[model samples]
Target: MTSAYWPLADLRIRSGPLELRPPVPAEYEVLADAAAREPHAHPRIPFLEHTADTPLRRGRRTLQWLWSDQGTWRPDQWSLTLAVFDQGQLVGVQNVRAAEFARTREVRTGVWVFQDRRGQGIGAHSRRALLHLIFDGLGARRAQYRAAASNQASLALARSLGYAEDLAPLTADDTVRHFSLTADCWRTRTDPVSTHVTGLAPALFMFGIGHE
Candidate 1:
């Protein structure tokens, strides 16, 4: 049904016990419920500020954010937000996005897992899947990441996945750190984790790939 109109709905990425896919209409409320249950409120981590106002607000914000991405998708600029599921249970979400990716060949990513699921290497596996999609499935040249300087977990994840810190100056706030991983580096990085992307061939056109 969804794949008949939006092929992206058919895309999936699997790494270990994790599965990443675009949330279907039925799962929209489920995603909002997850956000309400687990409000990510780290001051440094960039989350919707209004989410902490109330549980109802949190859920509303989550739905709005997801819908915005879905409605605004385009080949030149788009965000692919994948719901993370472990054994068919929704755990969290991982997002990979790019601007003019066909020419720039770069992408950025972010992830959020339920509090209970943290420290179980879910974040690492989710990222590996996105990297595979970026570099292998989409033929990206480099991948980028950004996190608040105080967000140790995010920075650690990037470093552990073989990303090098970017030397560029931070914004006026000087609160975020940037990192990058070239495709060559991703290919040679010795990480025990491996990922597989499926249904990508049918969705490549959605990402503006295979046109050239």
Candidate 2:
């Protein structure tokens, strides 16, 4: 499909009450609000290098991230950041991305929920939806996760999903941790998040799924 059509916009993955889709105006606004209001006291920010100090800053950063990733997708490497919505309201962001996916058949995941929405199982359901997309929709063989120790929530979620601790220099900080799951390892979690992926048949070639 052409960029004019933005075929990715048709893509949607749903699990239980959660849905993951490319960011639109409404979802982007929620992310900015969450970033600004969600406080992180640690010196090491939870995200790569994002700040939620102000609404304008958060808005710019989120917009930049969404547009840049959308513009740069390729079969060999890509970043697909989906907006996570709960009951039609934006709650967080979930990502499934990788490089040389055709040969490696791997993808990595990262998730973030609004500060006020935490502990309500949004993170878990969102990531499970991503895994469903990666492995089921995109045919990925492996999925990965890395989080700093200070990000206890992320680490805990990884463990709960049967991700195995892995040896990797995640960052300059030693507190950072890494984890991975093979397709086999992935089957263990067995969460009841029944997945539904649509708008994928036409996009299979781009993701190297099936005939690609």
Candidate 3:
């Protein structure tokens, strides 16, 4: 479906200099170009071997999973895939998922920034935006995040956002750290600063996560 008819046309979240919005079908080329330009810096899973350099053939396979039927549209599952924009340019992608969402009321989040965009607090801003939409807009009870032990930045971001670290297996190169944050914890923290989002509730639920 065209983005206009895809249901999340107006869905957006802004945090200071960042703006998170659903990708329009017209944006597929933009995303593809971005993916092709810098194919080494964007890692989808911290512990997985899915790097930007994983061949367009392999990349296409991954994209299919994210954009196809087996992807984000199941009734009990939802995914919000956001195009992270900084000053009007698509710099990265952020994904939030909820399985059995309507019943579980919980979501998990993951994000990646372009190589040149790293270390600028954009990751933090993008994450906070999703958290706001989940906790404030969707009434989610909790949000979970996992970071590879080697990814100090992600681990740090999770901690900064008040996610309590959970005990998990720590291995040589596959260490995974799980963290979670609740609505009450988020409310007690300072609200994220944004300028693009207003009435995010209706748009949030209708969009069903992955498209936006």
Descending-lDDT candidate ranking: 1, 2, 3
lDDT of each: 0.81, 0.76, 0.71
**Which scores better on lDDT, 1 or 2?**
1
Model 3: pairs clashing at backbone N, Cα or C within 3 Å? 14-194, 22-212, 39-52, 79-209, 79-210, 80-209, 80-210, 81-210, 81-212
TM agreement with the true structure for every prediction: 0.91, 0.87, 0.80
lDDT of 1 by residue, 43-133 (tens): 4323444433776777787888889888999999998889999888898888888999888999988888877888988888788888888
Query: In model 1, what are the clashing residue pairs, if there are any?
Result: none
Candidate number of the best TM-score = 1
lDDT tens digits by residue: candidate 2, 79-159: 888888898888888878889898999888778787778999998888888887787777788998887787788789898
lDDT of 3 by residue, 1-212 (tens): 22444445567788877788877667756665555555454343432245534546444544653465224475567666788999888888788877877678888898877768889988888888888878877788899888877788888999988999877534333567878998889889886475446545445545344334
Candidate 1: lDDT over CA atoms? Answer: 0.81
Candidate 3 whole-model C-alpha lDDT, 0 to 1:
0.71
Off by over 4 Å in 2: 1-4, 41-55, 168-172, 210-212
Q: Clashes in each model (backbone N, CA, C under 3 Å)?
A: 0, 0, 9
Candidate 3: where is the Cα deviation over 4 Å? 1-5, 37-48, 51-53, 69-72, 168-174, 195-201, 204-212
Residue 55's lDDT within candidate 3 is: 49
Top candidate on lDDT is 1
